[model samples]
Target: MKALKHLNKYFFQYKWYLILGTLFTFISNLFGVVPAQIVRYALDLVKETISLYFLYDGFGAQTVVYEIFAFSILLYGSLILIMALLKGIFLFFVRQTLIVMSRHIEYDLKNEIYHHYQTLPLSFYRKNNTGDLMARISEDVGKVRMYVGPSLMYGLNLISVFILVVGYMLSVNAKLTWYVLLPVPFLSGSIYFVNTIIIRKSEEIQANLSKISTFVQEAFSGIRVLKAFVQEEPSTVAFTKQSNIYREKSLDLVKVDSLFTPLVSILAGLSSVLVVYIGGQEVMAGRLTPGSITEFIMYVYMLTWPMIALGWTTSQIQRAAASQQRINEFLNIKTDIVSTKDISQPIEGAIDINHVRFVYPDSGIEALHDFSMHVKAGESVAILGTTGSGKSTVANLLCRMYDTTEGQIKVDGFELKEWNVQSLRGQIGYVPQDVFLFSDSIKNNVRFGSLDMSDEQVIQATKDADLYNNIMDFPEQFDTVLGERGVTLSGGQKQRLSIARAIAKSPKILILDDCLSAVDTKTEHQILNNLQEIMKGRTSVVISHRVSSAKLADKIIMLDGGHVIEQGTHEELMAKEGAYKELFEKQLQTEETNS
Candidate 1:
C-alpha cells in the first residue's frame, strides 16, 4: 500500500471519474435492494387478498378481488422491471468511468517509464536485461490496471450492495437477520486460512512464469545457434523440466483457488437453511410473514457472489501492490547522466582528452589510465590498439556514454559535461564495433542517423560506404527490409550499412570504433578514401587494430594496456623502429599472406 501511493497523483488527475463511479455503485445497489422489497410486498398482498376472499364467503366479491390482485401484480411487476433497468444502467456508467480511467493511467505510466529509460546512462542497460525491463513496463503495469479497474469497481459494488442489502434485512427482523448470518464466522475463518496459502502460491507461479518466458524468448532468438550446435534435444528437455515446475506450482495454486466456490456455495446454503427453518417458526408464531422468509433467502443468494469474490479481490490487490512497488523502484532511480545547458551553439569538432582515466563501475576494471590526446578542427587522428587496449573507451567518452573517473574531456574548448547531452551527441557520429540495424527497410536504417535526411544524401552516404552496388542489386533496393539485427545482409554489408548511417547526418565529428574490420583490404581502402573526401572539414577519430586504418591519419597514437606507448606520423613512427612499426609490419605481412 505504501508503494501503491505512487498512483495517488493519477487517481487525483481522474478524481471526477472515481467520484462518479463510486456514486453510481451505491445508486445501483440502492436500486438493487428495492426489487427484493417489492417481492416481499407482493407476497404479503397475495396472502391478504386470499384471506379476504375466503372471509367474503362467496358474496360475489371474488371477481373484484381477482381483478384487484391482477392489477396490483401487473403494477408491481412493472416496478421491479424498472428497478432492474436502473441498476444495470448505473453499473454501465461505473465501468465507463472507472475502467476508462485505468486505461488512461496505463498509457501514461508506460510512456513515463520509457522516457526515463532513455535518460539513464548505458551502465543501467549493462546491469539489466531487456526481458526484465520489458516485464516491469508491460506486465507489472497490467497488474496495476487490474487493481485500479476491476478490483476497485467490484470492491465498491460489494461494499454498497452488502451494506444496503444487510441493513434492509436487519430492519425487517433483527433476530432472523442474525440467524441467517450464523455461517459468516465459519466462512471468514476458512477464508483467512486459505488466503495465506493462495497468496504464497500465486507469488511462486508468477516468478516461475517470468523465468519460463525469458527462457523461451532467448531460445527463439538463438534458434540458429541452437541448431548449429545440435542441442535441440537437450534444450527441449530443459524446457520441459522448467514447464513441469511451473505446472506443479500452478496446480498448487489451483488447489487453493478451487476452494472458494464450494466454500461460498456451502455457506450460502447454510444461510438459506437458517432462513427457511428459523424464519418459518416466526411465521407460525404469527410474528412474521412467509414473505419475510423468502426475502431473507433472496438477500442471502444476492450476497453469494461478492462473498465468493472476496479471496480473488484480496489476492489481486496484493499482487498489484507488489507490482507497483517494482515500478516505483525504477521510477525513483535518478539517471546518472543529466542534460546540461548551453545547447544554442554548434560545436567545431576541436577535442582535447587531458590525462583521462576511467574504470567500469560494475566490474571495477580500469579501461583507461592517464590517456591524453589533442585534435584540431578538421584533423583526423587514429587510436591504434589490440583487444583490451581501451581504444573503444575513448569513443565512449567522446560520445559521453560514461564520464571519466579522472581528468576532463573538452570539445570545442568546453568540457564535455558543460555541453547539453543531446546537443553534444547530435554533433558526433559514432559507428560502433557491434553493428545493430533494426528490422526495417534499408532506407530507414540509413536514415536513422538523421530522420529528415534527403533520399539523395542517403544514396550518397551508402556509395561512400562502398555499399551502393550491393543495395541496388537487392530486389527492393532501398526498400529491402532486413531481418533481426540485419541478419539478411553479410557481415561486411552490415558494417558498411552502419557506416552509411553514421555518415548520413554529415556530423561535425566522426568516431569510427573498428567499424571497418569485417570488410576486405580493398573495400576498406575504398571507404577510407571516400571518408577522406566526406571528412574534408570534419574532425574524425578512427580506433582500430589495423595499421592500414591509421597510416593515413594526420597523427596516430598507439595504446597498450590503457596507456599511450607511441604517438607520431606514419613516416616518423617507421623511422623510429618502435612498437607502431612492429605492429604495422606484422599486419602488413598477414595481409600479404592472405592476398
Candidate 2:
C-alpha cells in the first residue's frame, strides 16, 4: 500500500491522461457488450422461426429471415470494427505518452541514485555488493516502469468492465443478479489471502536473485584466478546451488499464479451455471422472455474476464510493491559525506588533524585513535605503513570520503566539513592504488583531469609523467584507444598514464596512494624524480609500503597500528633504532637473500 502511494505520485501529473484513457476504455467496452446482446437477440429470432413455419407455409420466407440475420451480423461486425479502431487510436496516444513519461522517470531516478551514490561514504560501498547496486539502478527501476505502463491500465480496465457488466446484469433481474454474484465474495477472500503468501515468497525470491547476480559478476571478474587455482568445480557447485534456489522460488510463483486463475474461474463458472439454471426456470414460468434470459447469460460470461483480469493485476501489483520497497530502501540511504552549514571558502591545502579519532561505521572499531598530523602549504610528506596501519584511511579522510568521529580536521584554518565538497575535491589531485583508465583515447583520459586542457598541455603532462616516449610509440599516438581498464597497456604504462592524468589537473594538493607500485625500481625512481621537479611548491602526501619510495620525501612518517611511531628524514629514522630502523634492516636482509 505504501509502495502504491509512492508510485501514484509519479503518475499524479498525468491524471488527466488516465481519466481520458479510462473514458475511452469504457466506451470501447460498451460497444463490446452490444455484440453479445445482439447475438442473444439473433438466437431468440431463430427460435421463433420454428413455430412461424406454419404461418409462412413455405421455406422461401426463410431466405428473407436469413437475410435479416446476415444484416444483423454485419451491423455487429461493424460495431466491433469501430470499437477496435477507436480503442487503438486512444491507446496509441496513451501508450506513446506514457512510455515517454516512463523514460523521464527512469532517467531522473537513475540520475538521483547515481548522485546519491557518489556522495555516500566509501564504507557504504564497502559493505554493499556491486551487483546489488547495479540491479537496483537497472532492474528495480524497470519494475516501477512495469507498474506504470501495463499494470496500472489493466487494473483500471478491470474496474470499468466490472461496472458495465454488473449494471447490465442487475437491470435485467436484480434477484437473478444476486444469485450470479454469490461466488464473488469467496473469490475475493481467496485472492486477498493468497496475495499475502505470494508477497512474502517474492521478497525471498528477490533476495536470492540479488545473490545470484552478485555471484555471477564476481565469478566473471575473477575468472582468471579461478582458472589459475583450478577452482572450477567448486564454482560450478556454488552456481548450481544458487540457480536451484532461483528455480524453486520461480516455481512457487507459478504455483501461486496457477491457483489464482483456476480459483477465479471456478467461482465465475459456478455463478454462470447458477444463472443458466435459475434464469431458464424464470423463462419456463413465463416470468422472463427467452431473449432476456439469453442476454443475462451473455453478461455472466462478460463478468468472467473482469474477475480474472482483476486477480492477475492484483498479483502483478503485489510483486511491483515488493520491488518498490527494495528500490526505496536504496534511494533513502543518507549520504554520509556532506558539508556543514555556514561554510564555503576555497581551500589552500594547509591541512591539520587534531586529536582526530576514527571508527568504521559498521564495526565501530577505532581505525585511528588520537592520531594527529599537520601539513603546511607546499610541504611534501611521505607516509610509510604496513598492510592495515590506517595509511589509506588518512588519504580517505583528506579526500573527505569519511568524517572524523571524535576530533576535528581543518583545511586552510577552516573545519573540513565547512568546505564545499566539490571545491575541495577540485583543488585536490588523487591517484589511487589500482589505476583505472576508461576505454578511450589517451588524450581523452588525460583531459578527464582537466576538461579544457589543450593537446599541447596534455603532451607536456605526459612528458612530466615520463610517458611521452611510450605514447609516441603507438601509430595513433595520443589518439590510441586503450582497452577496458587499460588492459592493452603494460603495468608501468598504466601507472604512468594515471600520473599524467593527475599532473594534468595541476592541483594544489596531490595524494598518490601506492599509484606507482606496478612500475620497476628504475622507472619508479625516474617518475619520482620527475614528480619532484613538477610538483615543487605543491602540498604532496605520498603513501607507500616501500622505504625506497619514501626516500624522495622531505619528511617520512612511519605508521604502525594507526599510530605514527616515527617521523623524520631517512637518516634521522635509522639513527633512532626504532620500528623504522628494524623495517629498513628487514628489507635489506630480504633483498640480500633474493640476490
Shift of residue 36 alpha carbon in model 2, Å = 3.0
- Tell me the spans in candidate 1 whose CA falls farther than 4 Å from its real position: 178-195, 281-287, 340-344
In the range 1-595, model 2's lDDT, one tens digit per residue, is 6965765755676666666666766766776676666666666766776566446656799677667766766776677677667766766665655555666666776787788777777888889998888877777777666676676677666777778877877777788889988998898899999899888887787778889889998998788799999999999999999999999998998899888878888887888788789989888887767887778777877878777877777777777788778887877788767778546655567878898889988778777878888888888888998988988888889888889988999888988888888888888888888789999999999989778999988998899888999999999999999987788799989989998998898888899888888887678878888898876878889998887777667788888888888998889999999988888888778757765
**Clashing residue pairs in candidate 2, if any?**
none
Query: Against the true structure, what is each candidate's TM-score?
Result: 0.94, 0.91
lDDT against the true structure, per candidate, is 0.89, 0.81
In terms of lDDT, model 2 sits at 0.81
**Tens digits of lDDT, candidate 1, 1-595:** 7878988899999999999999998998898888898999999999999898778776888878888999999999999999999999998999999999899988988998899988889888888767668777888888889888888888888898889988999999999989888888998898878877865665566667667777887888888899999999999999999999999987887778788889889999989988999899999998889888888888998899888887677667777877777778778888766656555478899999999999998789899999999999999999998999999999999999999999999998888888889888988899999899999999999999789999999999999999999999999999999999899999999999999999999999999999989998999999999988988899999999999999558999999999999998999989989999999899989988999
Task: Report the number of clashing residue pairs per model.
Answer: 0, 0
Candidate 2 off by > 4 Å = 40-73, 88-94, 97-104, 342-345, 570-577, 581-595
Superposed by TM-score, candidate 2 places the C-alpha of residue 423 at a distance from the truth, in angstroms, of: 1.8
Steric clash count of candidate 2: 0
